[model samples]
Target: MQKMKMIKRGAASVAIALLLLPMADTAHATIVKHYGVDWSKFQGNNGKWGYARDDFSISQIGGYYNGYFIDQSTYGTQVSNTIALNRRAHTYIYAQFSGRNQADQMLDYYLPKVQTPKGSIVMLDVESGNPDTDSVLYALKRVKDAGYTAVLYGYRSFLTSHLDLASIAKQYPLALAEYKDYKVTAEPDYNYFPSFDNVQLFQFTSTYVAGGLDGDVDFTGITENGYKGGNAQAPTTSTPATTTGKQLHQDTHNYTVKSGDTLSAIASRYGMTVNALVTLNGIKNANLIYPGQVLRVADSGQGSTVSQKATTTTTTSTYTIRYGDTLSGIASRYGTSISALASLNGISNPNWIYPGQLLKLSGGSSARTYTVRSGDTLSGIASRLGTSWTALKAKNGLANANLIYPGQTLYY
Candidate 1:
């Protein structure tokens, strides 16, 4: 196995204040765009998930997303990763954590990684019966601190039963979801609309249902209602058949899932829902989606699963992460786990690496921080540092300092 690596740079002034700011970007160039969709397996007779031959040039994708799914504690990584990729859309995503717990890190995780948001707009879920105004406000404050624009995602009854919109509207955008022009499903879910202190993204009606890409997509493009009133807005998405058909026919199946296939953007693209798709595919979570995996268009008429063209290949025994190695290949070469690599060190996910990333399996792990490259170990490091393996492991929280990773730091 290769050693792990760790890189530490001086914090920029902007980074220090990032946590407390609202709507801040994590990456230097990533943009924010809010997106939504009817969310199903198949595109509406008119909508699409993958790129089609006719309307490749433009689209307004919607994913099957809701507050409860977004806000769930078990779904933080799932939500954050989706939000990160969808930083390219221009529609509001109604995110909700599963439970309203103070211990939940939905606000913290999202705020810290704002640079990748597709849409700069944010809408917090205020469950209809939820009375926890303080917790909701805390999440909102984090949004402000991150420097992102804010809105409240709720129906009229939810507001009447639980929220005081007049107060929340004082500072944030209130996304009023008023169901109309609709059919009742599961429960007697109706649209909402009323006078409120603030209103931005109002849903006058939602017949558009993104059925996880498995069933027919309920499209709003042909309808007179949705996001905008009949024939409303500047850049309305046109169905493939009706538009001028200038879009390139890139088969949706061809786009392999690289590290970039975060759930949010794809769900938005096809106007399907995230959780429904995630659940349908049996994905463990959002962060774990990997390259080479062909993402099916949730429904798209039940074809065989994606198949990779078979070729002869040789498997290498093991690897040591070099000073400037990328995680993509190492994870592939060893077929080792990404989470394992992360856990071996105190490394968080997706950060770039630099010199001396000590690879745990190969070696490294002696100091408070050590950049393990190809090979390192507690015994070897301890011997060199003139310390005991027991002492070194204890210094860090390693149950076994022997399990150090490349680029990880040792005690100074």
Candidate 2:
């Protein structure tokens, strides 16, 4: 994080004044964009690490400062909480411009402590200390070499003045910090955007929400992309397709559980629900699975018992909404759409879902017209609608398959 300097008002005074300001009109409220916050030890663990509406959260795990390693006190808690809340959790290392070996030392100490899954982005904060281009590059290279995507973060002036911004931008994504005012800015002003092509995130305000949480808007899909989950692998099982007479049979097989295997991942791999998997294996707790334990992935001969039950059961499958549950997240998990979920559940506002509410998992109406939602791709919608993407594109007269917006209705 860049050092924040105040002029006339103190921290408390500024927060109070901001809170007292009139809220924006409901009609003119900024469209919900990809918002995120970066946290350090200063934020503490009294629970306010980030906004509830945040799309992602980045926490400082540990870093090299002056000649020693400084570990953040709230790194583990923040990372775990972010993951538990189903938001993308990223980590950063504040590196000094001492030498190339400083990057190595920092990674050695912090990599073991990082809780995010492999291939997630790990930012290298290089705003403080004397700027050295070689040192920065060394740190970024080390971060990528350790099997995680690397992003460079620094103030606009610090990055432009002392570093090769063009060359660095070509090599790695940049998170530039250039605030306009002390007040919370909902969006970044592109007029003041730094000269770069691969800029992923812009730190628009240092006081996004009261207690010094920096507000960031992801211009590109850097934070939105990648596997943002626990360090778990799905079970390895072979689905052998054979023909007995005229009917094709998918042979059921067993999978020996490995370390870091999750029941959800295993179930998803074998096309079985978590509950069905648990019932089939007679497991007490879904979370408790050990290495080398053999579990049935599918049923043989007459097909899976879950599949048979699905065909015979007339009751509508449902899910109870939990804390931090979002319509978009739930839809993706169940292979449905936000519009479908909203229409089926009598929800006028997709953003507003309460905990403990029962939501139907299946039996949404097959309407001829479909409204697009955020994160909806053409192929995904086509899949849900039981049609080819090309056919949908031609029928809807869409020029670009990649270009679609929320609330845009398409007729099939």
Candidate 3:
């Protein structure tokens, strides 16, 4: 663990005000491109602390800094050297890991190593494919709670395919790592920007030899002048009105526990993790929800159960098929079974679904189409729409059932 001191440098200026402004209206200022390196590039640079790939000293490489792996356990092997190097370079520290509770622990361990000036970022490298969405969310929340300007870093596809970025995109400035269809001619050309609401930084490539390291561009204009400190106040997050002592009925809101519902199943349906559900609902025991228990399934604020504001508005009973839809996933979302959906739809095969297929909801309304969202599987879509993957594929004329893409539609 490293000891970090927060130092406010210079009189508070307009740049700091701009940095604190909400990102909903970030001006598309001509982004200044910068270059830097991560610990992976430092590996084997020098013998004992050969964790870096290249032996070039920090001052020699130049540009913005995002350094080291925080939760690799073996990261300590290079901590002494990394801290010493960062002290000379004043680089931002990144804490990379995949556990909700581990976020605080790792940040704690790395906090002592931060010798940089105050307001330095402690970005969370959120690339680990942890199925538990809440783990990352809670980890982000934990990072902010610790008074660090927590940023999220991962490739665009990985973020969309594996995690529900929609839940947290607005709150955290995305540090996207996307490498596709571009030659590294000089300053890298980033053709693919993430769909995240706030993109503060873009890491275009890990092979930018110009700086002999990974390449990044700062959109916030903070990194252009070098590392001036930024505060760690919590980012804005959406909070659903709470409902007390009643079952939730909003489409993506409250959920009623069914006979076969487990914490994992219910959490998945609402795009959350089991541990998150437990923490949100304050369940004394994770295995103790009853068949009729209504639980809160959204938001990082308030309790796990909806409060006095739970609504009774009925949602459309049918779901449209989107990319990444899967039979098991659909069933989990709707609190129904794949077999029931297959039987209802008269499908002989369960493994064939396509986009543009409509599916019936649990209430058995006319089949409706659902637009595919990132991280959606046919089964997951089926569960949410109260249909089966076979039914979805058959309705959409999909023979492979396993293939789907975003924006494609499906029927029940």
What's each prediction's TM-score? Answer: 0.33, 0.48, 0.37
Model 2 residue runs over 4 Å out of place are 1-33, 46-52, 228-412
Model 3, range 64-135, lDDT digits (tens) per residue? 112233233223222223332331122233444455555555555565553222333446665644534676
C-alpha-based local distance difference test score of model 1: 0.38
Highest-TM-score candidate: 2
Q: How many backbone clashes does candidate 2 have?
A: 0
What lDDT score belongs to each candidate, Candidate 1 first?
0.38, 0.61, 0.47
Cα RMSD (Å) per model?
21.8, 20.9, 22.5
Ten residues in a row with the worst lDDT in model 3? 238-247
Candidate 2 lDDT: 0.61
| Ten contiguous residues minimizing lDDT sum, candidate 1 | 214-223
Q: Write the per-residue lDDT of candidate 2 for residues 235-346, one digit (tens) a residue.
A: 0111110011001112345555544356765665456556446645668998788756777664332122321111222223687876545676565445456787798889
The candidate that wins on lDDT is 2
Q: How do the residues 331-399 of candidate 1 rate in per-residue lDDT, one tens digit apiece?
A: 422334456566655567645655466555323322123333337677777777677788665444344
